[model samples]
Target: MSYFWTGEGGVPGDFAYGKIHLFAVAALIVVTVLMCIVGKRLSAKNKRNVILVAAVISLGFEIFWRGVWIGRGVPVLETWPLYPCNLAGVLVPLIVFTNNKTLKEIFYVFAFIGGIITFVYPDGIFVNSVLNFSILKSILQHTAIIFIPVFEYFTGQFKPQFKKLWLAIIGLFIHLFNSEYLPRYFGMEGDYIFLRSGLPFVIPGVPQVLILGPIAIIVMFVFYAALDRKGSKAALRRKKQ
Candidate 1:
C-alpha cells in the first residue's frame, strides 16, 4: 500500500486523498502567515517589511504559475510533488526571519530572474500533480537552499560580492542532485509525464541543462552584483543619516 494518492477520474497515478501533500500545504500556509505577522511587527525602519514583501512576491509567483499550468491540463501538483514551487515557500520566508536586506534583495533578484528564465525556457516543462505537491516540494527545496546561505550571511561567513549568486547556484545544483529537479525519476511507475506526455525535459539531451545551468549562474552573478551595488548605496545613505 504505497502512500501515493490516485484522484478519481484523474490520471492513473494521481493521488485522490493526497494526505501527506495536504499536511505539508497546511503547514506552509500557517508558517507563511506567521512570517507575515512577525515581519509586520518589526520596526518599519528595520526593513523587515522589505523582506516580507519580497517573500510574498516570490511565493505568490509560484502559486500563480502553478495555477496557470494546472488550468492548462497539467496536474503538476499531483505528478511532481518535489517541484520548484516548494523552494519558493521555504526560501522566501527566510528573508523575513533574518531581516537581512542584502540577502533578501539577493534572493529577490534571483527569484525574479530565475522565474523569467524558466518561463521563457520551459524546455522540460510538463504538468505533474495538481494536488499541491508542487507547492510543498518547492517550499521544502527552497528552504534547504536558503538555510545554508542565511546561516552563512548572518554568521559572517558569507561574502557580499558573490554570496547570493553562489547560494542560488548551490540551491539549483542541490535540487538536481537530490532529484528535486528530476521528480519524474521517483513518481509512481506510470506518472512520469515527461516520458509519455511530450514534456520538454525527458529527451536525451545535455545541451539545455548544461547550457542553462551556466547561463543561470552568470545571470545570478550579474543580478547579485547590481543588487549589491544598490544595497551599498543604501547603506551609505543610512550611515550618512
Candidate 2:
C-alpha cells in the first residue's frame, strides 16, 4: 500500500513491457475497438458531450498527476505541464466547444497516434502494479486522450484530410520549440516529445528528433490520407443510397 503513493525512489516491480503492461495495452485496444463500433450511433450532441466529459476527466487526472509530483517535493517549476498528453485537459474541450477546424484537425491525428504510441511503449510510468498511482493515472489520462478525438472521428465531428497535414506539422514545430525552450528556461530535464534523448532506445549521441520528427510527420500524413479516403468513400456510398 505504501508503494501505491510512493514517488521519491524507484518502487519494486517497476517493469515495463511485462505482463501488466501488456494487459493494459490489450484492454486499451479492446476499449478503442468498442468505441469505434458503438460511437457511430451516437448523436452529434452526444459526441460533443462525451468530448466535454473526457476533457473534464483528463483535467482532473492531470491535476492529480501534478499534485502527486508536487507532494514528492519536486520543485513547482519542474512540475510544469509541458508534456503532450497534458493538452488533453484543454484541447479536448475546445475540440467540441469551438468552431476551430485547425485545432480539431491538428489534435485529432495527434491524440489518436500519440495515445496509441504511448500505450505500446507505456509512456515513462513503468510500474508493474496496476494499483500504483503512476500506472493508474497514466492509464486514465491516456484513456481520456484516446477517447476525445476518437469519439470525434467516429461520430463525424472531425474528418481528417491530407491537405491539413500542415496543421500537424505546425503542432510538431510547437512541440519542438518547447522541447528545447522549456527545459532550458525552467531547468527541468526531459526529452519532451522525444526530441532530446531520442526514442525509447536513446542513441549514443544523436538527438533523434531531427530524423524521427519528419518520419513521424510523414506517418501522420499517411494516416490522415488513409482516413480521408475512407471517409470520402463512406460519404459517397451514403449519397448513392
Candidate 3:
C-alpha cells in the first residue's frame, strides 16, 4: 500500500473523479457540518482558539507546500501564494488572528465560493490514490477553506454585510492586476490566479480574465446576500426567544 510520505507518485493522465475523490468530498462535507455543530457548542474562548489554530495550520501548510515545490525547483511565479485559493491560506489567518472585519468579509464570501468550486472540480489534485501527499494536501487545504467561513458564520463570528463585498472585489482586482500585468513587466510567464486562461470554462470571445473576474465578484455577492439574509432571520429568531 502506498503511504502519504512515500513521495512516489506520478501525475495521472486525467482526474478520475473516482472513489478517492468521492470519499474526500464526503469527508470534507461531514467535517464541515461537524465543525458548524461543534462550533456552536463551544465556549467563546474555545471557539476562538479553534479558529486561530485552524488558520495557523492552514497557513503553515500552504507555506510548507510552497517550500517543498520550491525545493523541487518549481518557479517562484507559479508557486506564489497569489491565487485566490492560495491567498485564502494567508487571509484566513489574518482574519482569525487580527479580527480584521474587511479581511474576514473577503474571506467569508470569496474564499468560501472559491473553495466550494475547487472542492467540487478538483482537477490536478484528484489523484487516483488516496495516499498521495499532493492529493491529501489538496483535500485538507480545500476542506479548511470551505470549513473556516462556515464555522465562523455558525459561531456568529462573521456577519455578512453587503458593503463588505467591495472589499472582496478590490482584493480580486488587485490579484487580477498582479497576475496579468506584473508578469509582463517582469518578463515572466505567470498565470498566478488563472486569470489569463480563465478557469476550466471560458466564454468564446471575451477575455478569460474579464469573464472570470466579474463572474467571481457577482457570485460572491450572491453568496454573501443569501447568507446575510439567513443570518438576519436567525438573529430575529434568537431575539424572539
Candidate 4:
C-alpha cells in the first residue's frame, strides 16, 4: 500500500496482457460511451463547462503525478511532459478553454490514437492489481484522453480536418528533438518519447514511435473519408426525395 502512494518501490516490470488490463479497457469504453451520451444531452453551455472541468482535472493529475516523481528524486528531464500522451494532457486544457479550433483538430487526432493505443497496450503504469494508485491513475488519465475529444465530436464541437495532420507531425518533431538532443546536451539519460527504442512489446528493428504518427494520421484520414462518404450518401437521398 505504501508503494501505491509513496513511489518507494522499484519500478514495476514490463506490462504483460492480463485480466486487469482487459477490465481497465472495458471500463474506459463504458465511461467514454456514457460521456458521449450525456454530452449530447447537455445544453451547449453546460457541455462546454463539462469539457472545461474534465480538462482541468486531467491536467491537474498529470502535474501532481510529475510532482510526486520529482519529490521522489526522479530526474526532471526524464519526467518532462514531452511524450505524446503527456503533451495531450497540456493541450487538452488549452483546447477546451481557448476553444482553439486548430489546436482542437490537432489534439483530437493525436489524442484519439495515442489514448487508444496506450490503453490497449499500456506500459510502466500497468499493475496486476487494480488497487494500485499507478494503475488507477493510468486508467483515469487515459480515459480522459480518449473521452474528451470523442465527446466533443459527438456534440459537434469538433470537425475533422485532414490538413491538421501536419500539426500532429510537427508536435512529434518537437518531442523527438527534445528526447534526442536535450539529454545529450544536459549529460542526462532520458527517453522522453521512446524514440531510441520502442515500447516493451514492440518487435526489434521497428521504429514504433517514429512510425506511429504517420500511421495515426492515415487512419484518421480514412475515418474522415468514410464519414464524408456517408454524409454525401445521406444528402443524395434527401435531395432525391
lDDT of 4 by residue, 1-241 (tens): 7876753465455554666677878887887788888888999999888888888888888888888778879888767665667767667766788888877765666677778878766767664443466676677777787888888888888766544546656655665676567667778776766656655546577777646556655766665555356654565588799
The lDDT values for all models are 0.47, 0.70, 0.74, 0.71
TM-score for each of the candidates: 0.40, 0.81, 0.83, 0.78
Best model number under TM-score: 3
Off by over 4 Å in 3: 1-7, 75-78, 127-130, 196-201, 230-241
TM-score quality measure for candidate 3: 0.83
- Residue pairs clashing in model 3 are none
Off by over 4 Å in 2: 7-14, 88-90, 198-207, 230-241
lDDT of 3 by residue, 1-241 (tens): 3545444665455565777787888888888888888889999998888888888888888888878777778887677565667767667766778888877765567777778888777756665454577777777777777788888889988887764667777767766665567667778775767755546668788778677767787787677667777664665588799
Q: Using lDDT as the measure, what is the rank order of every candidate, best first?
A: 3, 4, 2, 1
In terms of lDDT, the best-performing candidate is 3
TM-score winner between candidates 1 and 3 = 3
How far in Å is the alpha carbon of 1 misplaced in model 1?
Answer: 36
**Candidate 1 lDDT over residue span 37-73, tens digit each:** 5554556454334444555665565566567557758
Q: Tell me the spans in candidate 4 whose CA falls farther than 4 Å from its real position.
A: 7-15, 127-130, 198-217, 226-241
TM-score of 2: 0.81
